[model samples]
Target: MRSYLFVPGDRPERFGKALAAGADVVILDLEDAVAAPNKAQARDNVRRAVDDGAQVMLRINGAGSQDFIDDLALLHGLPLRGVMLPKAESVGPLGELAEVTDAPVIPLIESALGLWEVMTVARGPGVERLAFGSIDFQVDLGCDGSDEALLHARSRIVLASRVAGLQAPVDGVSVALDDEAVIAAESRRSRALGFAGKLCIHPRQVAVVNAAFSPTREELEWAARVVAACERSAGAAVSVDGAMVDLPVLLRAQNLLAMAG
Candidate 1:
């Protein structure tokens, strides 16, 4: 899934529009996006969406919170693609997840403690991937949300996910609602940092994020050529397009093609 678009759980009216926005997955958010007064209503809306059989995921509130407890009740016997737990910092809370649902859990690493304890969180039971909550992370660190400022944090999350044998982490949203250039650049930056997907706040951001994450035509062509060379060479060394096609290079090419598909 290249793009995970979030729609507020309370806004059931927008759920279908979000679903049709070309996102790989639509997340009905119960956290951050919902206000205290509307949480109950949001839960009801999410339940109706489930009853109507929307294929989606849910972003529950932070672990150990009262809302988190209520959010778990909403998951019972529903058909969901996955669950995203925000403000994740420990696996102990995650252990409770096993009793409720078997769906994949994505831990949103958003704070200094969450980043520090990410490896353990990645290795937590039922965790399928890690997600970088970049905005909240910046707020927690009191740092500017620049590529340079967040480089170390992003790299650490990527490494932890890899070491824990989970899927590549998902990056946070780009707040630029109208600037496709800025949005596309941010999505590309996420890919360059080893993220497999990105969290999207707006439906309009979906197309740009999808395009940025997808392998370009030139990349696909090169990958195809390298794959052909690798197959023909079998166990022998080879060159493709004047570039040496070693094991690593060949593997990279094959992976690129698979991703493009």
Candidate 2:
């Protein structure tokens, strides 16, 4: 899954549009996007979507909040791709997650404490992956949202995900709805930082994010060549494109091929 697209839960009409937008995973958002007064209505919309078999992922509110409790109550029998837990700060809330539903939980690390305890949270019950809520993380830290400023947090989340044997972390949204170049650039930056996927807000950003994460033709060709050379080298030193094709490089090539497939 390279692109995770969010649709407001209250906007049930947009669910089909979002699904058709070609995102790897479409998320019904019950937090941040919906107003407090609309929470119940949003929950109803989500329930209806799932009841109709949408097969979408869901972004629930923080654990322990009334909305989170209600969200789980409504999610009891829904077949979803997964559940995203926002503002994840501890394992205490995540302990009961496995008991509530069998859906995989994705912890959104958006705070200093959450980042600090990322490994533990990644290892929490039902945690299948990690996501970086960069906007909220910056707000919590009172720091600039530049790539440089958020680099450390992104790196930590990626590392924690790898250590916990989860898929690579998902990067936050670009917020630039109209600019394709900027959105693609941000997604590329996330990929450079070891993120496997990007969280997208607009449907227009899906193709761009997916392109940024998916291996390009050139990359696939290079990996194929490297792999071919490695097959003949038989553990000996080899060179590909003027650079030494060492064990690590060969492994990276193989990983790229697997990702492409």
Candidate with the greatest TM-score versus the true structure = 1
- Candidate 2 residues lying further than 4 Å off, grouped into runs, are none
Cα-based lDDT at residue 228, candidate 2: 95
In order of appearance, the predictions have TM-scores of: 0.98, 0.97
Q: Go through the candidates in order and give each one's C-alpha lDDT.
A: 0.92, 0.92
The per-residue C-alpha lDDT of model 1 at residue 124 equals 95
Task: Evaluate residue 80 in candidate 2 and report its C-alpha lDDT on the 0 to 100 scale.
Answer: 87
How do the residues 48-88 of candidate 2 rate in per-residue lDDT, one tens digit apiece? 88888888999998887898889878778778899999999
Tens-place lDDT per residue, model 1, 1-261, is 899999999888899999999999999999999999999999999888888889999999887788988888887787789999999999987888877889999999999999999999999999999999999999999999999999999999999999999999999988998899999999898899899889999989999999999999999999999988888988798998898888889889989999977
Model 2 lDDT, residue 138, Cα: 99
